[model samples]
Every structure is written in structure tokens, then in C-alpha cells.
Target: MLRLGNPRRRIGIGLMAMTFVLSIFAGRLIQLQGLDSKVYAAKAAEQRVQEERLPARRGSITDVKGHELALTLEAREIFVDPSEIPDDRRDQVATILAKELNATKQTILAKLADRTSRYQQIAAAADPAAAQRIMAHDLKGVGSKHRYRRDYPGGDLAGTLLGFVGTDGTGLAGLESTYDRLLAGRDGKQIIETGRQGQRIPMTHSTLLAPIEGRDVRLTIDRDVQWAAQKVIADQVEATGSRTGSVIVMDVRTGQVVAMANAPELDLGNWMAAAGADRVNRSVTDVFEPGSTNKVITAAAALESGAVRPETPFTVPDQIRCADQVLKDSHPHPVERLTFSGVVATSSNVGTILATQRIGDEKLHSMLQRFGFGTRPGTGLPGEEAGLLPDWKDWSGSQRCTIAYGQGVSVTALQTASVYQTIANGGVRVTPQVVAGTTGENGAFTASPPAKRTRVISERTAREVSAMLEAAVSEGGTGNLASIDGYRVAGKTGTAMRYDTRCQGYCGYTATFVGFAPADKPRLVVLAVLQDPQEGHYGGEIAAPVFKKVMTFALKSGKIPPTGTRPSPVRIRAGE
Candidate 1:
């Protein structure tokens, strides 16, 4: 009854309720604007402030003496800001940019037509001069960004060993790929303030995350020695018309690789222009039957097992039949008894087999293992192969005899060099190393120490073997071609038939030569391999001469003083 009498009062009460609701809504809005303003503002800034990555420059690679091998330089990438182009002059701008950037007109037009996109790349990497020329045009949409490009100043000298970088500025092969992480730098971030037109405002507050430069790598290679080795090998390969070849030089005392070269080397400046085979470092990758060059291992085995002495007598026959297989010497020799040294000097397959008979399969294989055969050399290079050496359990009747003269067993150039280095270093097997040290951007270097050595033979045995090797380079020996004018050399020549993939049998030959110099105090060990020489295919005719040239230059350039006199047999053993 009271509500029915007071209509005005009811209307006033409803208006009051509506006023209270509006006050509560206004209070909530003020709280949100004042209390949580920073939180909302930060979220909005994150949406508009794009953080861009700034890439750090990769480190440089140098030789042992800090000569640059691989380095990075600043390059440019051309792009276009589609939204910046004026509608009236879009066609003219597209036509000029397409021709200058080597892009099609249709492609450029399409990029300029995309009004929604702010930026579009025309070319990823262009020459600095070309990029500057395009910038001189002063087109509205045209832009350029800085990038890094890899360069090799040494050219093809150490190309196979240093390798090349890929299109993405990442390492792709050889030592480049093996140590990618250490050589590649970190990427940083930049938070920039933008204007109303989506342009970066100059002098605005910018938060930057600094980048870290990569660590520099120093190799054990000598650039001069490397160039000399390459020149020698390339000339030999061309003169002999060989399908492929490799040369390696090592320090006998420290096992440091002074030079490793190969023919058909890829030029890092234009790596893609060459074939894939040219990119391979044959010194550590390609394996072949070492032929008579492997006689060093057999001779060491016999000496270590006491199966034969340097002067021990044995008969050298023209041919010897062993278990369904017939073995023959390079030249037929009269069936006469000769000293063990004479057998090795002449490289008589029959004598090697006879000595193997005394040592048997077990002792011979054990000695081969000691010389770092049938296994990887652990040089820390990519695509390194462990040359095939069948286990003793897998040896067939004739396989044993074949392996004695280096017929069945296979080895890489590095493995062969390591064998000679062991003998040169007084029978201690030291692992070969390619990297010398790694340096930080702060100019501090962490060097790699000398490799650990394991004794494989008595020092007496090493001296006897050294004398026998000297005899091999003497007059009337197979490796006489390896002799130098002023210095005495000790080396062995190898000519083994390669297994023809098409013929399914041994057809073409692989020529090889491995030896040490000075005949008394060996400083360097050199190994050369030629695959399928068109001219005469013997190691003496093809590989030994190349070895002579490289060894002579290495000794002279290293300034190693000559021993002056031929070492007496008594003096050789006395040092041990």
C-alpha cells in the first residue's frame, strides 16, 4: 500500500541503485590504470619492440707461425622494404633493381607489389661494390645488410686440409667441420625503438646483448713447406698423367705435420667449381695396398721377433709358390743366398715371405699393429679411414704370404708416414697432430702438447733398420732414384696392382715411396703416392723422384745441419 502511494519515491530509489553501480565500475578502472600500469605497458612494448640478432665474426685459422689460412670478411645482402616504395614509381624501381641484382623483372615487381611486407631479400650475398652501386641509385625500397664471407688467402696450397665454408657461413668439410663449434661465434640480440611509420628511431634507448667472437685455431703446418710439397706433387702428377696423388711431410721428433698436400686440390675461393674428389685430403682418407713400401714393417717385424738379423743370410729366388698363390719379385734375381739387409735393399718378395714364415701369422700381425696399421692414425681429421687389415682369424692360406709383401693389406699415406716416423724417432710410435693451438679473442692461446709415445722396438733394431734403409738407396738398389745430391737417403719404393672395380681383379698399379733423410740423424719423414700413372707405373720411376725433390727442399729449408760423415755400424747402436 505504501509503494502504490509513492511512485516518485520508487523512481528515486532505482536511480540511486544505478548510480552506485556506475561508481563501482569507475573505481575498478582507476585501480587497473594506476596499480598494474607498468605490467601492461611492458607487455605492449614487447609486442612492438622486435629484437634482432647480431651475429659475431668467426675466428681466423693460421699456420704454426701464425700465417693466415682461413679468415672472414664483411659482405652485403641486398633487400627491399616493400612498404616504403611509392605507388607511382614502383615499376621503375623494380626494373632497375632487377637488372642490377641479376634478378628477373617479374620477381622484383612481385616483391615491390607486396604492400603488407616491410622487407624482402633480393640477393643473400652480393659483392660490396655491387651493393654500393645499387645504393647509389637511391631507390626508396632498396636496402643492404652486412654479412660475413669466408676467404682463403693461401689459395689451393692447403685447400684439402683447411677445407671450405658452406653458403650459410658454416663449416662443411675437413678441419672446418671438425671444429665448427669452436670456430663459430655466438649471436646477440638488439631491442630497438621504432617510430610511427615502423622506422627505427635514432638516438632512442636500445638494449643490446653483446656477441662473443670465436676462438682462433693455429695449425702445425708450415706454409712454405706446404707450397713446396704441393708444387712437387702437382708437377709429378701432371708429368706422369696420374689419376690422383698425395704427399705428406712429418717431424720425426714431435710428430708435427709440416705439410700435407694433394693434387686436384679445390680452390676455397671457388670451391663449388671443382669436383667432390678434389676436396678430399688423400693423406688421411685414401687407402691402398702399400706394396714394397710396406717392407719397412715386415723388416721391423722380423728384426723385433729375432726371426732375422740385418746380416742374417737368406736365399732370394725369382718366384716362390705359397698355398695356391705365386709371388714374384719386380725383377727376376738369381737363386742365391743373401744377407737380410740385401733382401730388403732389393725388395725381394720371396725373402719377405720366407722371413714371414719364421715369424708366422701371429707375430707378423702383432708387429703390424704396433706400427699403427689396421687402425686409424688418430690425426683428428674428418673422414679418416682405418685401412683394411684382416684379423688373424680371417687370414687364408695365401693371404698371409700376400700380406707379408704388402699385397693384401691396405694403408693410408698417413699410416705409412707414421711407420717411417716411428723408426726415425728411435722406435717410439708418436701420434701425429695437425692442430698446434687454439687462441681466444682476448689474445690468450691454449696449446696442444706433444703426443705420447709408445716404444715398439729396441733402439738397436731401429738403427739396424735405418742402415738397411740406407742400403736401399745405395747403388743398384730399387729406391736409388730417391737419393739426393748432398745428402744420403733411406727409402723404399712400392708398385702394387690396384683391384680393378670393373675387371674384378688387380689391374692398374699404385706407386708409392716412403723414407727418411740424412741416413744418420733423421729429421723428416716423406711419403708420396700416385694412383694409376699413365707412364711407367713403378714407384721408383714415378714417386721416388718426387720424394727426392720434396725431401731435399724440406731439409735445406729447415736448415738441418748435415751429420758430415757416414755413421759406422758401431756408432749407430751406441746411441741407443
Candidate 2:
């Protein structure tokens, strides 16, 4: 429809347009391939490569006989990448995850709402089957990682002693916390290249370091004995409606703790659900007045210092005056002549005070320290409290006499048990030990060092105290309930006013009975303590029976036959 121009000129214009366009494309390609190559590659690498942690296997906790108490099992940690989940599909994916993984839908939805985060942990220690179910849905951004979960095979047995682990697999309490370094080992890591969907890119995985597995911790606790002790103490606590209770059984010669049981046991599998107070290992942590259980120490001091003999007589009455407090025997009685052994047999608070006057406060204080009072029992468990032992110089006027009768001084169940263990071991105090040995990652077994020993009294003094304790368990004595038919038993009963912080003073009673078997040749010492019992609060009434039950079991289990000799008659009445 128009006049034609020069054909060569039209062709040249078209060629010019095409050349400009190609030139611009070529420049851009060169810029991308050369000048900005490293920058783009770095950005791509940032999106494709990810660091992953390889969890180390936590060690096993076994009892003396190689019975596993706590262990680690393989598990999965489910996670989600909010960036990969579409806004419209987030609710659907969250719903699937909540149902399959047993997680809260609201929690999963909250994590899915954060589109900026590439990784959000949805659940830890998740069951492999649950993780598999989650993956079956092919929900975008949902994934899982290999993890190690801590499990207590015994459930609540020795739960507080074995302690618990945190979500990150770190020890949080008890022996687990005390020996975390040995049990946690070393965690390793790996770097891998991933695809757009966060899938592992084959042949691009590299482990930066290999994980080191934790070493096994072997404890001196006997699994069967522990179970028995726990059963008995837990039963007693329930029957008495006690606020708390504890039992300690020690190998007299070795100071190795056979069983340390507490009531309302901490169930390791559900440790988080337990209250903080219930989580404590009260045997070593809680402190209480020893009550009459401390009388044995007074007897030891008096016998050791040559201030009194088992036959020495004291004129005792219902009550005596000391400082501003009137010290009295547990029960009211008229003035009566009681021999030194008789005073112990009756658990006479007044007689003990009169006898304590002979050695004086300083000597008694020294004796308490020698018996491991006011010191850590060295059981190697976490939260071990050195019982409160005030220096004699700091004693209030009333404290002097009260402490003499086992009221002012505070001692832990372990410390009280150690006192009788000293007597049972013939006056030599062995440091209490919980851990027996350790098995290394390389499968090497190493035994714990020998327990430290100290002589608190002469063998003769220990024997004298032992005889007095035997008298205390004799017929018509305070702890007569602790007597066994076949074997001679020696022990003391204690009923002290419990100190309560909430009350800011004494509130309830702490009943205790500590004793050993085969009076002639003591082998094992068992101590049972009950705090704030609603029923009977007398050691002989409630606590002594527990001691007898545990001791009978331990004696029969250890096959320790009696000395085959009748207990020597100690005159309980002065006129006799």
C-alpha cells in the first residue's frame, strides 16, 4: 500500500536491532559467569548446604550386679521448615503432625506460622513409628533427625539416685548430674549439601567429626536390694502418711551403699511431672535432729573417754533442768536408778544429758565430728548436704543440753547411718561410696578408689556401745521391736522434733531407727527415717519395723548367719 524504500537499508535496520539485543544478552551472560560468579555461588551454597549435629550415645547406668537402671535408646527429633510449607497448607500439615507425632496442634501451627525460620523443632525423643507416620503424609517441610533418648528401665526404682536428663540429653540431677562429663561423652557434627526441598544431595555429605560415646557408670547399689528397700520404705511412708521417708543400707566393712531408697519415688520416665521437693534425694539432702539415734554417739564418746562404763549407774527422773530448757525423758517416770546401759535401753533423755556432762560439750562435739557429723558423707551423689553441726562455742545455752540429748544438732539420714556403720565396722569409719566403678567407651573397666577410713573410737569402745545398743533392742527396751529371733540385733530409736522452715521452728517429729545385725560380729547397718508422720511418730513404733524388715531381707540375702552365741546379759536396772 506504500512506495517501497531501498531493500538493503531496511535489511540493515533490522540487523542493527537484532545486534543490540544480542549484545545486551551476551554482556549479561558474561557478567553472571565471570564477574559475579563467586557471589552467586556463595548465595546458592547458603541455600543448599546445612550443618547437622550427630548425637552421641549416652552411657548406661548399671547397678553392682550389672543390672541396667538407666540407659539411652535411639529416637527421633521431628522438625519442620516453615519456609517450605505454604500458608494455605500450614493448617493441614500441622494437623497431620499433631495427630501422628502426639504433639499439640496449636504448638505445631505456631511453629508453622513462622515462615522466616527454616527449622523449628516440633518434638524431641519422638517414637520412630510416629515420625514415620508423619513422613507418610508427605507434608512439606516436615522432617526428623536421629537422636538419643534417656530411659529409666526400672521406672521409679532408684530414680532420684540415677537422676534425670534434659531434653538436650544433658544430665539434670542426681548421679547423672554429678557425673555428666563422664556420661555425656562428646557430640559430633556433619555438613551436607541439600536440594531445594531440603533432601540430602547424594555424595555431598561430610562428617566433620565422629561422636564419642559416653562411658558406663557402675554403682555400688544392688538392684534387688534397692527394690526391696524402696518397697518397704515406700509402704511405710504410705501407711504412716509421712511427708517423706528414706532408707539407707550400707556394707559396714566397705562403706558401699547397698540401697538408698526414698518415698514418693521420683519416676525418671516422668521426672518433669514431679514436684521439685519430690525430686530431692532426701537421704543425703534433708537434715533433721537425730533424736535418740544420736544417743549411741553420746554413749560412744562416754565409753571412749572413760567417763562412764556400761555398768555405771545414774539417778534419773522424769525431767532435769539445763540452761533455760527442761530436758525430759521420752515418757514420764518417777526418780529411778538406771545404769549406763539401762539409760540407753530406756532411751532416757535425762540420763544421756547427765552422762554427757562427764565428757563435757567439747568432747561430745569432737566425737560428733569424728563420726562424720556436719560433713558430707562422700557418697558422690549430687545435692549432698553436709549436715548442720554448730561449733560447741556457738551453741545457745539451751542448745548445749539439747544437743547433748540429740535435739539441737541436725544430721542427715546418711550421716546417721554412717554413725552406726562406724560402730558396726568396729569404730573405723569408712567414707560412704555410691559409685563402684566405671566402664569406659573403649570397654575398659576401672574400679573406684578405695574408700577413705578414719578411726573414731577404739575397738573396745565400739564394742561397749554395741552392747548398749543390743540392750536397747532387748525385751522391754525402747527398740525391742527391732529384735530378730535368730540373730542378735543392736540399734537405737529416735523421735526428734522436726525443724520446718515454713514454721520457722520445730513443727513435727522425725522418727528414726539405725541398727546392724549379728551384734557379736556386725556386718550390715540399716537406717530408716520418717518425717512428719501423721500416724505413730515413734521410731520404735514405725521406723524400727522398717529397719527390721530391710535388715532381715539384707541378712538373709547376704547369707550372714548369726554369731550362734546368745547376747550377753547387760544389767539394765542398777539394783540388778
Candidate 3:
């Protein structure tokens, strides 16, 4: 207490006080200038220099004529910085976003509750109107980014073939799914200065790398033909009260599918509302007993194996008994003798079984495989099923007979069309090609090589089978309704019983017709398949007429000239 009075002690106390104050200041200066400098500089840089990835635009899907089937357009995606949102207005902001973006209030609230997060996705690919509404409000913390939105301008035109894109910009079906790799491009990046609210600072120096667009996919589909097919099939399906229907149009020479249409189309814009089954590409995915339409394969096998000739005679009965099942005609009639050509022309189940019996199961299966049954058509469409064709070694007596007439075995519309394409192409089975190739960034097109081809039968056999098919479309044949004036048309009619899970057996019928026009030198193969029709369910009654209209339009549009002469008739002599 008396130290203040002493000179020496007072001098020492002054020095000590000076040293303590200097030490405190020096430690704070070091902390501010050295230890925490990098941390502070980084924080400053975040507000001045922002790095972000630039999204790449997805590719377009086009028809052979460069018509857009699917594409991408600039659309707004809503985002947010929860930290920038004022606490007092949080509920108000959430309510506004929920109404404009069609999002849940709870979702927006949860996002707003995270005060630490600087970024959050509020909505993806919102329409322009919604973006406009949000901008009009000019609310704080709400932001938008322009991103590519997958679009199908033709509505459901080629929905099954063009497929769809998901919210994350990935292909999910059809050709889109098949060639997704080439369609999704690489993203880029940019480093720029941003304000606290995440807006770009004006006139700030920045680095940017531009995004590359995906290659455009050019399909072999003819938009006109596709539209016609889709319209006709949808109409017929609704008229006949069928559950579902599909149509396929293909170029005979190239095995390129011109159109693949399914009824009650799956609209790409509203895909989420469509039933999963409706979105299926029935041309390749769904299998049905081909009914009498499969007779062409049997006829080809018989002719190729030299088991029978067009003039070979068969005494067809109304009902024929196999091992355990009785095979009967669609309508009952007395026994009548018909030529091998007449057997096919009439779509006679008994006569076809008799013809196939001569060919044997092994020869028949070989012919079916050669015709591209029991395998994918190699069209590049994903999820394609190799329609159920069991081996000859597993065939029972009834199975053999039923298979001969297109029952007990299943096939897709694609396989059925390929069979005719094989015959039309002179027995060489060519793989179906969906995409022609890709369009380069320079706007140059690279053509894809034609798919592999295999000779399924000799020219002589193909010609013979084709002639039999011609007679099948003749005046009195079952496919008579399929004929078009000024053109020589050849095709088969099919009406097969459908299996019912409710009863665990055959119940309803699936009608089908597959035909080509200008039969002498065919150019187009068109097929119409109808499932479970309530009225006039026979192939000839329902499917053939539709085939005629669609094929007529296709032939006209394709500029195919009519042949001057109709095909000569094949006469069947009565049994002696």
C-alpha cells in the first residue's frame, strides 16, 4: 500500500503496465493479420467470386424429315437461400412459392427452416407463366435458374417410339433410352462474382466454359405415316371397344420401321398420369398368340423344306382332334378339299396343321427362327421381348398343332411384321433399324449402315409363299377386306383366343392383320393388331379394314405406282 510513495517501485510499476498493454495489443494484431487472415480472405472471396456448373442442353429427337419428336427448351427452375430469407416473412414466402410452383407448403417450410444452408431446390423446370408470376412478386431470397426442359411438341404422336426423359434429364424409354449416351451432353462451368443474395455483380471479371449440346438423333420414322397409323388405330380401338391396339409400318427393303403406334397414346407431357401398361411399346414388348397370321411361317417352312407344293391337297375337316384338344374353325362347315394355296388363303386351321405335320416340328421351328421369331428384332428399342417360342423338343401334340395355327405360342407385332418383311424382301430377314444415325454439330448427317441380313428361305420358296398370300387376299379369302383398289395387296388375317387370368384359360380374341402393298415388288409392310374387341373382333372384320385404309394412304404418300395387272387367281380343285 506504501509502494506508490517509493520512486523505484513507481518506476517498475509504470514499466510493467506498459508491457502488459503492449502484449495484449500485439497478440490481437497477430491473430487478425496472420492466424485468421486466410479464413477472412476466403469469406471475402465467396462474396466476390462464385463458381458454378453450366448445364448442357439435351439433344433433339427428329423424324427422317427433321420433324421434332422430342426436344429441350429453356425453362426456369426455382431455388432458394434460406439464410437470406427474413424470419418474419418466412411463412409469407413459403405460401407464395407453394401457390405459384405447385409445390407443397410443408416442403417450402422445411427448406426455409434450414438457416445455415445457402442453396435449396424449390421446383424443377417450371413453366414460363409460373416464373413470370414469381418475378412479379419480387420477393427476397427466391431465385430461379434457367435449365433445359424435355418437351414433345407432337403431343403423343410417337410417344412409344420417341420415349421420354425424366426430371433429371435422362432417357427412360424407346429410342431415347436406347441411345441415351449420345443424347446427353457434357456440362460446363463458370467462376463469377456474386452478391450476398447470389446475384451476379455487374461488370465483374469472370471465367466461363460453355456447355456442349448433345448430338441430335435422326430416326427413320415418317411423321406423316406415324400420325395416320396412330389416328386410325386409336379410332378403331375405341370403335370396337378393344382394350388396346397397336400398328406398325415398315419399309420392306431396308427393314426400317416407319411408324410404331400404340392406342390410347402415352403423352410425353403428361406421362405421370398415364398407366404403365399404356406407355408400353406394344409393337415389341407385348406378346400375343398370332392366330392365323402365323400361317405364312408354316407355309414358308412347308415350301422351303419341299414338304408340300402350292397344289398339294388337304381334306380339311370342321373339327380335328389332336392328343387332348379339339381344334375347330372359327365357323363350322362341312369338310371341303382345298389346295395348299387355298388352305393358306382360307386361313384353315386344320389344313395348316396338316401342312405343318408334314414339315415336322424341327423344320417348322427352324423356319420360325429364320423368320426372326423367338428373338428380338434388333431395332435398338430396349425391353424388347423375344416372343415365347419353345423348342420342338418340348412340344406336345396339342402344342404342335396349336403352334401350327398360331396358338399356344406367342409373338409380338414386330415379329409378325418381320415375317412379312422377310417374305416381301425375298426371304432375307433384315434387322429393323429405328435410328438412321446422328446429326453432327456441323449439321451434317452420318447414315447408319443397314442392319445385318440373313437369308431365311430360297427366292423360289419366298415367291411361292408370297403368291399363296396373294391368293389369301383374293375375293373369297379371309383377308379379302384388306385389298386396296389399284394395288396388289397380300396379307393374312389372324383371330386368336386370349388367355384370361380370371379363368386361367383362353377367353377373348385378339385380331391381327399384316400386309404389304404392290405385292409383286412390295415396298411397305403395315400391320394392325387389336386386342379383345367386343364387336366384330375377327381379324378380317376389324383389323383388315384398318389395314386397307392405312396401307392405301401409305402407298399414296410413298408415291408407289399401281401395277397395271391384278395377280392371277389360284384355283383349288375338289378332291376326287
Candidate 4:
């Protein structure tokens, strides 16, 4: 009886199974169409919609006269969607991409073979033309996306000051790093439709959020002057075989840095091409015992205190013993008397010590503070050193005597220039500035105010010191080599043996020259420093010529009229 009923029962069971399947399908349709419509809609939107990042263009950086220094160019990033590639063409696609992207064949194959990953970057920062070529092949999985690249049009000119950006589109050094927030713009996002192959669907519904462009930056550097200074310093460093060198040119009126050049120099476009030392802005960062260049501060202190006059004479000595230390000139001479101006012109350490003795420690320290020593120059650049000026209490007998002639105390090239600038700008101490202004995304520009000046000495004292500085360029003076053909130059040459901490004695020498032009109407202050010269160790021999070349070009570039009376070029005696 069971065998006879089997066929009919099986047919009934099959029909019941078909009904159950149809009922379940209808319930799913109701849920999708009504009960879970909102949730499904959201899921559909998420699948169909693609959010793309829109990066804003970074701002351009220009010189004071609007010459472009750093700018951005449109570029592209090439990538591959591994899942989109057909299995049959995978090897061919991987080979072509590997060669073009400079990637290993194994790397490309591994990326393409990764079924778990939907997208993979093949090459970041590909040039537009190269990216176009790659996209023209129209490989199944390969694609390109728009991006930005930083360009330095000026190349190595002002490279140390302008700095460069990293691969991640972030600033790495210099002004770029200092003003990163202002230069980097906000990134926007947009929702766009995508195809099944992971490519953006053309002309699909898109919700765009516009990105805000970054603000522009204008610097106080003059490209021409910067180039000239860099050239001169580089040439000088090579010629002298100097271990390192730096040059700085600053505007006397506004305290704006006109040119800052260091050798070795770096090319911002290829930062890794140069050594780490070449990337250093020694003018602002490195400090050394300035030698006789610091006599300006001692002279200023004496002048401000009314303790000495330009004509005031001091009992000069060939050697003076302070504590257990014996201080002598570069060469020993008999005890001689000299005027205050003569003291600076000859760079006599004894005379400076005698003058400082009259001004005392407190007055001299106050004057040094006003000259911007022992503190950061406030240049707003990273790694700006405040320089080393030990407190007055830290000054012992030997320290005080040595500091008078620019020994013991340390200062950067910028601080030395500022000291001359203070005298040049009628004894007003102004804060040095590099940035001229910043332009906002809204097309409004905010300019930096004129440097704040505080009167540190009487106008009469500045003029008096100016006259004494002029005397230093006269016949038989240490810095006579700094005099240019058409300009009356006032400056001092400094040669101090660098104290080797490891050796606990003087090792090499740092040669320096600090001066300003057109002694009657000072316009520019230039400071040049050469660290550890091999050929010639004297500041007058190693550093003064560089200053002459730079100051001559800078004065001419500034359109500073010649003084009409040319001082005779002092013939420097070898080993004098």
C-alpha cells in the first residue's frame, strides 16, 4: 500500500515546496519595497555614491617685488584597482605598470594579485604628461587622479630661506614650514557616482564642496640681491678654501632683510642634493665669537654713556694681563697711545678693554642688550639663535677683557649686522623682519608694520660712531680692504681663534667683517663671516674681500649714488 501511494505523495510534496518558496519571495518583496525601504535606499546610495577629496591649491610665495619663488603646478597620482583587472591580462598589465612606475615586477604582481584589496597606489606624484601617457593605454585597472606639485622657479636662489615641501605636500623647512598653516589650504569633499569597475561615472549626480585656496606670502628678500650675495659668497668661499661662510644684507631704514646667503647653499627643488650643513641658514642660526666686529657694541656703550668721545685717547698696550690670561694683538707692538677712533681702526684689544673699563660692566651689558645681543633676533624663522651673551654676573676678569674685542661672547651674523644697522639708522634699534606681507584667500593683503625702533643712543652719538667707523676704512686700518671704489665704507674686520672645547684651546679661526655703506647717509648693513679658512686666516684677508664684492653689488643694485670721492684702495700687505 505504501509503494502505490509514493508517486502521488512525492508530487504533492513538490507542489508544497514550490508554494513555500513563492510565499517567502513575496514576503521579501514586501520588506524591500515597504518595511525596509529607507534602510535599503541608504545602502543603495552608499553603493552608488563615491566621495572624492578636492584639495585646495597651496598659495604662491614671491619676493618683495613679486618675483615668484615657490609655486604649485597641477600633477597627478596613478593607481590601480586590483579587483577590476581581468585575470587573463593580469601579467601583461603588471609588467607595463611596473616598468612605468619604477616598481619591482614582484611588487606590481603582488598588488595586482591581492584580491582582498580593491584599490592600490602604483605611483604617487607622476607628472601630468607621464600620467596622461599611462592613462592613454586605458589598461583595465589603471587610473590617474589630479594632484599638486611644488615648484621652485628660482632654483638655488634664496633656497635656504624659502625652503621646500615634502612628498606629503607638507612644508619641511624655512618659510614654508614657518607659514605652513597659512600656505596649506583646506581640503574639500564631494559625493559622486561610481561604476562597477571602480571608475567615476561620467556626468553623474555630484554634490561638490569647493575647496578654499591658501593665502599668498610675500617676503622681504630681493631676488637679485640674494642671487648676487650668494654668488659672491660662494665664489669667495671657494677661492679662500673656507670651511663655511655666510653673507647678510639688510635695509637700514625698515630693518627688512634684503639678502641672506650661506655657502654651501641648497636648491629647494632638490634638497637632498646638498648636505645638511648647506641647508643651514648660518646668518640666523649659527653663532661665533665675533672678534673685533663686536667692538661696535663697546664703542656704542662708551658713546652712549658719554664716557668717551671719537677724539678721546686711551693708553694702548701691546699686551694686557687680566687674571692669569694674557691678551695681545695678532702681532705684538710697543705700548702706543691712540684715539678712540684709532682704537677701532687698528682693532686694538687693549684699547677696547680700557674703554669698557670706563663704561663698566652694567652700561656695557645694557648697550649690548640694546644692540640685540644675547637674545633671539626675533626673525620668526625656525632655529633662530638668541646667541650666547653670558650674564654680567657670569663675566669674570678674563671674560670681560676678552668680550671687549669680540672674544668670549658669541653672536650670529644677523646680530652683528643689526649692531651696524642700529648705528646706520641713527641709533634706533629696530627689530629685523623678513616677511613683507601675507595675502588672504579673500584677496585682501595684510602688510607687516615698519620695524619698531627704540632710540638707544643720541642721534649725535650715532653720527659720531659713524664717523669713527668711516675712519676704519682709512689708510692702515684693519678693514681698509672692505672699502669699495665708489662708496665710503665703514666697517671692522675680526679674526678670532675658535676655542675648541675638545682641545680646551684655540683651534681654528673665524674671520668676520661687519660694515655699512655711504657713511654720511647709511643705506645698507652687510655682515660676512668665514669659518676656519685654510688659505688665509685673517678676517681682512678672508672675509673683507667677500664683503667688498657683496657690498659693492648691493650698493649698486640699491641705486645708492656714489659718494663722489673715492677712497684710495689700501694695498694690503701679506701677513700684516
Best by TM-score: 2
Candidate with maximal lDDT: 2
User: Residue-wise lDDT of candidate 2 within 343-426, one digit each (tens)?
Assistant: 998999899989998998899999999998888998767789897899999988878778876888888999999999999999
Colliding pairs, model 3: none
Which of candidates 1 and 3 is the stronger one according to lDDT?
3
Query: 185-298, model 4: which lDDT tens digit per residue?
Result: 887888888877666888888899988888899999999999999998888889888878899999998899999999888888789888877776778888788998888889
Report the poorest 10 consecutive residues by lDDT, candidate 2. Answer: 198-207
Task: Report every candidate's CA lDDT.
Answer: 0.86, 0.91, 0.88, 0.85
Evaluated at residue 341, the lDDT of candidate 3 is 91
The order of the candidates by lDDT, greatest first, is: 2, 3, 1, 4
Query: Model 2: how far is 569 from its true place, Å?
Result: 1.0
Better of 2 and 3 by lDDT: 2
lDDT tens per residue, model 3, 1-576: 553488888889999999999999999889988999898899899668988878898889899899988998988889888988899999999999999988899989999999989889898898878988997898888888778799899999989778888888888887778888788888889999987657788998999999888889999999999999999999999999998899999999999999889997889889888888877798889889999999899998898888899988889998899999899988898998999998988889998988888989999988888887888888768779889889999999899899988997888899899899999999988898888889787768889997899998899888888888888888878999999988899899999999877778888899999999789989999999999899888999999988998998888888999877768668654453
Overall local distance difference test of candidate 1: 0.86
Q: Answer with 1 or 4, whichever has the higher TM-score.
A: 4
Collision pairs in model 2: none
Alpha-carbon RMSD of each model: 6.0, 2.8, 3.1, 3.8
